[model samples]
Target: MSLQQVEQIISILNKQSKPYEWVIQEFHKVDELKDFDLDLETFELLGLAFYLNQDNCLSLKTRTTKIKEETFCIVDIESTGGIKHGQILEIGAVKIKNSKELDRFNTLIKVDQIPENITELTGISFDMVENAPNLKQVLRDFKLFLRDSIFVAHNVRFDYGFISKALHECGLGILLNRYICTIEFAQCCIQSPKYKLDVLKELLGIESIHHRALSDALAAAEIFKYCLSKLPYHVQTTEELIKFVKTSRTQRKIAI
Candidate 1:
């Protein structure tokens, strides 16, 4: 679709305050999107970028709902620190439900060579992954393991971005899993001088083999459980937890 057409739709949304269904009806008027194979729900999902109010289209705002009785996958990855330019060396994750670990996935990815700095930082060397499976195979396996669970990580964006990019390059497509960053959760729930994963591990007395993907992921899982316990009693669903974390972070930033 053309930029002008998209702009026109946004303009319509801005001027007309209507329900989400009404917005879709208006979107149908657009020539580009009219023949689009996607359905109304899919189209509304895209409207999330515009931050449209599902109930009443007024101003742009983030939308989050409840997430009770859902599964979570805490994930971590060790890479060359240049995901866009370099390679992923390892991936580790743990699936959790009802605050209990359901399963685990850990693997080393074969790479041409591991950079000296990366090896020093992660303790994963060229020799370690030389015989391991390639990125395509590892990503395929990880995707199956991950399924549709909510993705959790210390600094979620980093791991999520790297994995998403790796998957795309491997022809696996983008990751669509909803994700929560423990860093944000910790900031909202804990009182610590620093919110780094290692620092939290030390403060909480959680044993960890720092810099390894699985170890870090396990640590993050612990932190996530702790944060969940500290959440308001009313915050039960995944959507509520996410919204609470984001709102709390914003309030903390304003306080600072």
Candidate 2:
């Protein structure tokens, strides 16, 4: 088994009713070089440790069944304006694995500039952002959070394009992660004439609580879950889902 799988199995065992601590202690009882010296009945002792533990073996078996599934980091951003040229004011993302929300990343960012109208609209004044982390720092943390998962967002090009640009400006390389656009995913699954987030959320009964970074991120995560429920099993892997995202029928424009 992979090391991560081993770690997860250990975690599961720690939470269960089984005598896992005793099993771990039994393994420790055999000193590293001592086992080699104990040339006393090699095959018998080998069978002893391996056979005295049905619980340890069963925990591993359960976790192996779970390793085939993949996870996604659903994201959303609230910016000063709709344009990619406009700076992002806040960002939020949630990791979903095996139908569970596992991790989260969220932050408000300091922007280089913000117009009075944007300040009025988003309540994100320049002074408010002055002390916040710059895009570079924020992107660094975001990159660590995103590590190799499928990225999902509503109107994904807008969020993804701005993120790619921000990361590039920070001297970080472009993110080539497989991505899924909820707007397009909905269009494909539900055939909506209009797939705006609020529109689709209202139509589908997925409520948007705050519409700010975390709230929108949660809503987008729900939308992504809905899309996943509709997709076939073949599109389950991160790479395969990215392929589906790339071929989505929605018209997405690349920001200049």
Candidate 3:
């Protein structure tokens, strides 16, 4: 589809003032998108616009001039765990530029089988996700969801590690995006002894619903925002913040 057609869809989306999902549904009805195969840039742009409409995130505006226009995708995964590697049952993420939510995506991933204990803990039964999109499709969709954005998560390393491994196993390239761990930033910025999401949420008074993908994404986004507010002024740009996070462990090692 032509950019003009996409632009028109975006325009309609911008004017809708509806919830994000409704807008997505409406946009899908557009003639161009009916059979649309979005090129990478178009998909990213569309995704950004999708999140700009969120009420919770509208208050945090992007200062594009102050930092690189590079976006950040805050991610959370739900899985069957404590193995060498485990099955990812769900994926959730929200993109942010400046401080505003740009776009979001969440998907349930169908695995060949789910363990019994795994089903109990997560309430994600094998039958529930049986007809859901497989890992390959979900990852492809997520990679598109995250295009041009730095990957971020609470602990961050685990989410990125799991995703990197999953993508590689699917014959897709590992994500080369820069990343920051909110947990690391929390250690640097907050005095809490523990940084688990629920613990930190209680300490910060950021109420969150548990286990669901979008809820977890929202909680991670909140934690990230709190950390951003606490960072030193010198670490203003995305590049500078990345450097600070990269060197944070070195500083801790020296102190130890």
Structural similarity to truth (TM-score) of each candidate: 0.74, 0.64, 0.69
Alpha-carbon local distance difference test for all models: 0.73, 0.63, 0.67
Steric overlap count per candidate: 4, 0, 2
lDDT of 3 by residue, 17-135 (tens): 45544545544565435444433344343333223533632211122324436577899998877324587889999988776888889888988777888777667787789799999
Candidate 2 lDDT, tens digit per residue, 1-256? Answer: 1223333434544344345455454433433312332221331222111122455432222222221366577898878776545788899999988769899998889987888877765566778788999888898888877865667888887787788667655666455454678777776566565877787778678876555777788988887777667665656455455446557545332111
The better-scoring model by TM-score among 1 and 2 is 1
lDDT of 1 at 141: 86
**Candidate 1 per-residue lDDT over residues 103-211, each given as its tens digit:** 9999999988888988888888788887999999998888878866778999998898888777766655555455789999888877788999989998888998999
- Candidate 1: which stretches are off by over 4 Å? 1-68, 250-256
List residue ranges in candidate 2 displaced over 4 A: 1-68, 82-84, 209-211, 245-256
TM-score, cand. 3: 0.69
Quote model 2's TM-score.
Answer: 0.64
Q: Considering lDDT, which of the candidate structures 1 and 2 is the better prediction for this target?
A: 1
| Ranking of models by TM-score | 1, 3, 2
Poorest 10 consecutive residues by lDDT, candidate 1: 58-67
